[model samples]
Target: MQTVNLGILAHVDAGKTSLTERLLHSTGVIDQLGSVDAGTTQTDTGEIERRRGITIRSAVTSFALRDRQVNLLDTPGHSDFVAEVERALGVLDAAILVLSAVEGVQPHSRRIMRILRSLRLPTLIFVNKIDRVGARTDELVADVRRLLTPAVAPLGTVHAPGTSGAAFRLYDPRSGGDANRLAEALAEHDDRLLAALVDDLPPDPSHLDEALRAQATAGQVHPLLFGSALSGAGVAELLDSIAALLPTSPSAEPEPRARVFAVERDAAGERVAYLRGYGGQFRTRQRVVAYRREPDGRFTATRGRITRLDLVGAAVDQAGPPGRAHGPTALTAGHIARVTGLTGVRLGDQLGSPAGLDGRSYFPAPTLELVVRPRDPARTLALHAALLDIADADPFLRTRVAPDGGTSVLLYGEVQREVLTATLAEVYGIETECGPGRLVHVERPTGVGAALEIIGHGFFGTVGFRVEPGTGVDYRLDVELGSLPLSFHKAIEAATRAALDQGRHGWPVTDIRVTLTHSGYWSPITTAGHFRDLAPYVLMQALAEAGTRVFEPCRRFEAEVPTDRLGPVTSYLVRLGARIDGTDQIASGWRIGGLLPVRVEPEAQRRLPDLSSGEALWSSAPGGDRPMSGDPPSRPRTDGNPFDRTEYLRFLAQPRNRS
Candidate 1:
């Protein structure tokens, strides 16, 4: 049997979740159609999801379509939950991008399509809400070509659109014009077909059908379809396209290989990992090694044993307990499964071998940071541990602790902030007091500098580093990596970035090159512990000598306000330091788009409604940093003031740091 790990994505209110429900019901997986408004959807089983009427986590369900077993992953659509969508992207075999016919092309929709095309992942566009007023398929097709891609093939046509009686008619491949159109669309990328089309030759209808399917599979062409997931219109044609056009799963490799895209816990409190099999099969109770792809492009292998395995068909509540899973069996390649007992497995870990991962991130790191304190104050340690656990579940949600024992976490925007606050109280039972959001700025070296500490210089290990401005975190060594014990080397290398996390001015330093200029240790006395403490001590000295400059975070924004209210909205945005780049007249309002300092973004969003009398729409995504013209903001000193050599050494002597 063939398997397809299909992902369905969309902007919020685009009806992707509804489409998932429609597909499930049509395939006999659900007895009754699920409703998002009613919070009865099969995939959105989370408490917050049901309450907010939005998907915050990626949910999976499986159903058989003729010879293909479709494992459908319904991903979150809110901009704040892009991290959920990002994880799903790494595991999908092909995707169906749902767009609202009424909204036409949206900001987030464009972002999703851009990533899909960049990955060259096979995509099929489904223009939904054909039954809603103002729905226009004819013009939206042109918009998709102009804004998203030109490699689009309209798989069918819509009739009686924008009404309750709307219907869809798929193109008949056996017809003369339909066959010619398919051949012509493929000809844009196929030289042979282009030549035959130029000669006015009638290509074999079956051959054209095969060519269209092949091109779609290759991601060179996207077959577009129209539908209303609510009314169940155009769904049959979509299933037909999936079974006939999408590529089937490949055979498994001899060495079991897979990539963990998500991690969850069952009611019994077991760590369950969702892995996309790439090269091999994982069996029950099988001993295995997992290669975790760290954020720094380093792959670390950890050993674990698979205690239990479950297929995609049986799943409920990625957060808690659910339907009985069918497993404790072998999970072969091309299939997705929930496996247990691999406690060391983390999200994005490559199991068995790294066959198809590049270790490059598609999303930017969060720039907003907020200092958080538990309302009870005594739950401080609990809050920190809870944060670490949450970060483990979704690596993008990072946390940092201050020297004063205060806690702070990275967040994307206001929505995430609210979600985090609610989650800590709801899930962990930790009521929290969150401070005002502060934009996280970064510092980079201003010049080159170096520092050193030899073994006899008050420490057990000898460490030194040279620092210079560069991109990301580049750590090279003047000495061989084999010069010291691997564990010792790992200690210093790991602490190198942690040292940079809090520079002399109290901001995370970036775009720096650090080289190990000296490495020596006493044979018996020197250990990884000594190196960990000593490395940071030396690195910070080098960074202080080099000096650093701070830059502020910015965001790209799109806003739509009533044409008459545009002036007031623009004025409010400008007051928040937004730079207007372009403005266009949209159907319902004036589409005002620009770049703005992220530090002022939250305030802008808060006031946008009042400025437009609650008739405006706005969205913003992360943007490149801008040079700070004024004094740089200082973060609450985390890392116990690592720049203070004497104080830091004394702090390291404590039992907590010693471990």
Candidate 2:
């Protein structure tokens, strides 16, 4: 059987969990449906998720449709858990975007749509909650077309009963007008279908299905459907559509390659690495080589064994409870499974033969930092150990121990902080108090700068560097392959990364490019270690001469407030340095959206409710870094010239005094 890896994504309260339950229950994978509100959903197995009624982690479950095995990854919809959503994207073959019928296209939904487009994932939009009052399928479809992409083609619609919410009919696409329209839309993109349509021949169901699959796989078309997962309406067709329209993974390879997307410890305290096998086969106790990219742009390979294999959605015996281990000994390609005893396995690690599968390209940076204090100061080391475990599972949560023996955790937002606090107290039995939150800052080069340095203190090495601002959120190092010896190139790149970790302002640097313009060393005295140690000094000197600018993180937010309070709210936001881009009048009020400093977001959240009498709704997400207003902050330049041997020696003698 072929395998399909599908991700179900949406904004919070969009009924994504309910839809997952309906799909599982309709396929006969489970005897009874689990409710998200009741905290009984299969994917939401975490206690914190159940208590908060929100998914904090991405969970996986699988079921079979026809001859295909479909793996469903239910991702968290909350903005705070976007890092979790990002991790799942690297492994997904396709995605299902859920939109609420009543609410229409939300802020986060639009954000997810952009990411899906960037990833080039074929997507299907499911308009859920058709059973509720004021559920206008037509308006919601129009909203999606207007706000999102115009390439969306509706597969079917939901017809609601007059009196009852549960009784509804999902018109078959074969008999509806949409079927013809869908065929036309698919024909516009598929040459074969277009030729047949132009020949005045009626569309064949199989041909149309094939065309839809082809167009969707290429991300040329997105099919939309209407349903209510709560009422079990339109669900059967949804499953059938997934089985027929989605593309299946290619055949397994003779030598297996797999990518690890998530890593965590199970209830038994055993480490589990969740992976999707792109090629080859993996067996229990199989020997595999894990390959990871180092800072110097090289692959580091480590040997490990898969001690156990747990296939998702394996069948349960009649006499056993549901979800009991079926004990699958091996997993073939195009399959998702959990394996144990991979000690060095990390997120984005590739296992087996490294012929395919790229490393993780996206890593969400934590926007908020919290100072954590343990109730018992004596147990500080234990708290740090516990935090390391959590950090290992969720790389977004970066933990650090301060020089003063205090601990801090970098997180996404307030919701993540709450989840962390609860987890620390309940799971690890570590009582803690969190301090005020602060926004993370980054530094970038303001303009082009260059520096040349010659080692004088028995180093016997010379290095030259040029610095400039980068375009994206990446620290780029450019050097010709044969510019220098391979060993020197490696050492220079690694040292450059270490130097970039801390800017002169004591914050990490981002979006900057450094080039090793010239380099030389004496064969007798110069070594890779010497180059590595001296590279930082050269890079820092170049950066200081170029001058660096500090940029605080910012987020764009939209809020719906009463028209009467719009003037004051707008004025207040403007006073806080917000740039209002647009405003639209809604039924109840005005919707305003713009960019603002994240540092002031909490204050705005607190004041907006009171200003609007608790009648306003708002949402925000990371919008990248922006330079601070007024005079751009700059780091102190080095007083002595790097080319002057005497001045350079004096500067190195008292680096702290020179700056």
Best by lDDT: 1
Candidate 1 residue-wise lDDT, 502-523, digit = tens: 8777888888999999999999
Q: Which tens-of-lDDT digit does each residue in 1-659 have in candidate 2?
A: 77899999999999999999999999887889998879999999889899889988888999999998899999999887777787788778889999988888988898899788777788988888887877777777777886678778787656662224643344344643545676677777777757756785556677677777877877788888887888887787788778867788767777778888778778987889998887778888889999876433456788998888887766667778775576555677778889999987766678886665444445347877788888899879889998988876675677666545668788877888899889989889999988887667878888888887766654568788888887433434454667567887778777677667557665667777787777777876677877775777787778888887789888889888998989988998998889898999987789899999887888999899998989998877677778886664432233233334466456656745321
What TM-score do all the candidates reach, one by one? Answer: 0.88, 0.81
Give the lDDT of residue 522 in candidate 1. Answer: 92
lDDT (CA) per prediction? 0.85, 0.78
Candidate 1 — which residues are off by over 4 angstroms?
173-185, 191-207, 314-328, 455-458, 480-486, 522-527, 557-595, 600-620, 646-659
Q: Per-residue error at 187 for model 1, in Å?
A: 4.0
Per-residue lDDT value at 327 in model 1: 37
